[model samples]
Target: MEFHSNSTVFHCDVVGSDAHTTVLLQEAVDALAVKPGGTYVDGTFGRGGHSRLILERLEKTGRLIALDRDPAALAVAQAIDDRRFSVSHNSFSKIQEVLGQFHVDRVDGILLDLGVSSPQLEDASRGFSFRLDGLLDMRMDMSQGQTAAEWLASASEAHLEEVLRNYGEERFAKQIARAIVAARARQPMVTTHQLATLVATIVHARGRENKQNPATRTFQAIRIYLNQELENLSLALPQCVQMLNPGGRLVVISFHSLEDRIVKRFMRQLASSDGMPRKLPLRANEVRLLSRQTLRLVGKAIRPGANEVESNPRARSAVMRVAERINRT
Candidate 1:
């Protein structure tokens, strides 16, 4: 997939229907408090489900800048012929830079739907799923970076264990890592089924039974580590906060616990008053003047409704958190 300066076109063949039932569709956009004449950003343009909704709420003068690391996603984003919308082939972490390129200092709202998209997961060649047998490449951006197969082949057992434990929260990480190291010595682990089978074999022996596939956590760990998903989120959060104008909304929909934890903590830290000694001999007004609050939490985290989850199982794990930029005097 090649990215041009003005527009990015994806060369890879896209499999399956490009249609994605975006989780919390109306809820997420509503949280944005979008202003028809103001500029906004969609950090993850997965199939443009949310982008289209945002555009509908915007006027002719309103602008929407969409960003995505996946070439396939960029292809879908390019289909939007609206003059008010522009797509960028970059990660959400580069939100600030992308805004600068558009001469946008701050935006009225920013929406980020993090993690892998349906199209990427459904396409076997993209290697995002273990259920479908394909290459062991789980990269969000296949244009660059080492594939999951290459990482597994070269990573030490300790490193593998660390990733599985920290990123995937897998309990049998040590055993799985040991097994991977031993198996790779006999032959290279280069396919999704190969890796999945290896993990299932080890996990099953431990007598663990659940609805989810045994290889789920391992696949997630490898994908997260290889794609630097968590790191990108950490970097993008501060940038999103800084790029929002006063009263601007920041809506984030995270899929897993790890992602949700980071979002929750970041928002809490910013929403809390600056840590100051309570014993200080200062009046209430003086304390209010001294306290620094960057954000006002909108409400509690939101989860998909039972009907939505039944229709789209992927939405089951999603959690949306909303906040607004606090205007400082």
Candidate 2:
């Protein structure tokens, strides 16, 4: 999946009829408030689902800059032939630098569909799905960093436990971590099923909270830690806020509680402004607002409609939050 030539236009297609549905597609794009002839950024680009819609809403002069850490996605992005479109092969965390390269100081809108793309999970070769017996590789950017298997093989018990508890929110993190360490000492922990089985064996469920697979949390923890999903997200959020033009929108679709919490807190703090105390204050109309309010939260987090979720179960976990940049007086 190599992308070459800036002039080529890509018409992305589903390789199989079974390609995963892009969760919360319309809602995320609508939140962008996309306008013709305005520059926008689709930070995750995945299969160009959101990107194509953004381009359609733009006028001839309007530009859309799409970024994806996955080379596979970049390849699809490169295949698109519109002169108004350009693709960057970089993580959204490097948003500032990548946008700077194009002399794009500010954008009309930015959209981040955070977390793993569907292809990364559906493709057995990518090794992201626990349902398949593939390699334990889960890096969004395969060109760099350690695979999940390598990390698990050498990670300390304490560090593994911390990741499981913090990222996966699994109560049996300590036991799961111990199991992995002990198992690896006997033989290198490789392959998805192998690790999954190890986790299931150690995490016993005796009570009512026993329906879900025991390996689910442990796998999620490893993937999140190895990919640094939360850290990357934290880095990207402020960059998105800083890069938007006045009245520009930032629409984020976060799949898990941690990501949603970060988005919620960032927006709440921005909206509240933590204004000065009403010390010796004048009338309410005469009061001056705080100096640094940059963002205004759009609305409450949006979840998928029941019909959409029934069609694509992956859509069930998605939550979209939107915020708009304010004009600095």
Candidate 3:
């Protein structure tokens, strides 16, 4: 089946026995330019795919700190008994704090692989998959925060429409929001199937030709919003930059356009020269001096190959961007 054509169909079949095939795994680690004795941070630490590879490249003196907001992921990280590696149950947004606790101020490289992990998606109780009949909870850290069901139960129709439009980019956001409100009036939406059914019914009525599930966008938007995924990414990017040593690398693997856009824009903004008036009376050398940038874009954005995507449809939308810190006087 052409699972990549539809987000729902793609995710539904990969179940209990399946493992997350880290997209662009070697590419991301190689971009880090790992030094055997250097310090590195795996900011997302989703199942230790990248972390284990990093450890392999690290020498006895090399250190790796892995962080994740999800407790389940942290539990898996705890099994690593390496003296050079440590796991923290914290979001990457707190990278600075995590470093402080370890008495470290800078790292040689930092990698953040964004989006939901395979374990989270396949575990029906997490409510990350639309195909799963589970509670509507979508928190990356299930220990805290409001579940999707709780948020949807009280969000205004206008807010719902806005989330669907802006976060999900759903063309039928208004219709879906209206349908959700109407349906909720009859009863609370407490399960994944209920919400998915509601959205599919509304989208199906529109007679769209796309094979993608109608609920895909809505589910994505809710998960993003509830987890403050974009907000956390925004917060973490600057910290990653600040925590890097001169020549340090920042590698980000984003799974969707929204995440990729933010990563692209942030890296570009840092790489760009300071904006000066075109008519400034300074000499060319002065202009160049004033335009010193903090970051250097390492390379072009990368995508998974057809073979990788064929084996793991979830990698279809993956994009990896790399940047290096420029030494400042």
Q: For each candidate, give its TM-score against the true structure.
A: 0.92, 0.90, 0.90
Sort the predicted structures by TM-score, highest score first.
1, 3, 2
Residue pairs with backbone overlap in model 2: 9-79, 9-80, 9-81, 10-79, 10-80, 10-81
lDDT at 301, model 1: 96
Off by over 4 Å in 3: 1-18, 274-292
Best by TM-score: 1
RMSD of each: 3.6, 3.9, 8.1
Task: List model 1 lDDT by residue over 215-309, tens digit each.
Answer: 99999999999989999999999999999999999999999999999999999888886555577798787677556678889989999999999
Q: Looking at model 2, which ten-residue stretch has the lowest summed lDDT?
A: 1-10
lDDT of 3 at 224: 92
lDDT by residue (1-329, candidate 3, tens digit) is 11111112121221122256787899999999999999999999888899989999999999998888887776667667677887667888888888877678889999999999999999999999999999999999988899999999899999999998888999999999999899999999999999999888888899875878789999999999999999999999999998999999999999888999999999998888645657769888876766567788987999999999999999999999999998653
For candidate 3, give the lDDT: 0.87
1 or 3: which has the higher TM-score? Answer: 1
Question: Least accurate stretch of 10 residues (summed lDDT) in model 1?
Answer: 1-10
